[model samples]
Target: MPGRIDARLQELGLTLPVAAKPIANYVPTVRTGNLLVVSGQVPMRDGVIAYTGKLGAGVGMDDAQAAAQLCLVNVLAQAKAALDGDLDRVVRVVRLGGFIACLPEFTAMAMAMNGASDLAVAVFGEAGRHARSTIGVPALPGDAAVEVEAIFEVA
Candidate 1:
């Protein structure tokens, strides 16, 4: 039988991709005390950089939103790995940090990040509601349109 969270994911048609290995010195996830910190995850899917380019230059609002959602999926992947596949152990989504790659004049960073926030709520219910910071960046690793990192309080 699938875990409760896994079932929820299924119902939403979301399949968490395998956690991406750290490309540099940092680990993908770090657990300290009751908190798990997942490193920034780009919009990677099926082992490819699924979304790339600056939001205001070429990427549309909807695509950037999807990219944000994908980044959070990777975040959950890391969290699952850190918890030995037990996503139900997640107690709360404490915080989320969103980085949006966009032109200097762009101002819709918050709307783009709403993609991840909406999914978080769908997956964790009230516990997924979290404090968040969203910022516009000139660039990101792999030229991905969006990156999202998370702090999760877990059992």
Candidate 2:
């Protein structure tokens, strides 16, 4: 069965915010074949960037995790928007990629990414669990602690 992403979000005490319009030239999501490629998402709440800074430098690990979690929330919001409010169309989380802006030695990128991974699995069961790569980067937009992008297979 396709996942009940909306119900799962509510179960987690979360309500996805409206998807944000792209700030630049790119679209928020793209569709090709049965796949939907969601663009990189930041920790945005309402219409503003919620968390900003570098991990292990300007932001703590806990806050980084929260920031990553918020990015996932935006991913879901974008997905719903792409599908016109029908989240049931998502079949699986195909892949995930995250960039963590961090100090030279910080190695907690994957740990922060766990917030998104945990949400995926909780929402989609086994299908939401997928390949992921989380790597430390020198900088991200708004100097956010973390940013995440997702690829999903639609039903």
Candidate 3:
């Protein structure tokens, strides 16, 4: 049996979306030793960017949070792909980096990132907790509302 990730997803009424394909020359994720470094994930589903806009401007805090959730979904999708859909190989979530294109006055970046943090804990248990940086940016490609990257430990 796999880890509790599937159950957790059912509990949350969410399903991990398919991992987004690389837009440029980089891969979606890479593994080296015990670490898996995941590229930044934008809020895309079904090969389409679901939310594309700046936070605190064209997008709201709620929208940013949802986009952040999609980012995590993409992250998990990448992890599952890397582990051959066997989440049992995961060990820990090392770190997460989130970037939001938002208005300078927007002060709820952390709150928006709760989506990612919450999902991590739900899927990876205590190991999901990690050091993170949630920073505001002036703009992002495709005018995306949020972006997230992560590092994970694996067997």
Q: Give the winner by TM-score: 1 or 3.
A: 1
- Models 1 onward score TM values of 0.98, 0.94, 0.92
Candidate 1: where is the Cα deviation over 4 Å? none
Of candidate 3, the 10-residue stretch with the lowest lDDT total is 1-10
lDDT tens digits, residues 48-115, model 3?
77888777777887888889988998988898898888776778999999998888998888988888
lDDT pick, better of 1 and 3: 1
Q: Which candidate is the best by lDDT?
A: 1
Off by over 4 Å in 3: 1-3
Query: Which candidate, 2 or 3, has the higher TM-score?
Result: 2
- Pick the TM-score winner: 1
Better of 1 and 2 by TM-score: 1
lDDT of 1: 0.95
Candidate 2 per-residue lDDT over residues 33-90, each given as its tens digit: 9999999999988777778878877788778888888998899899999998888899
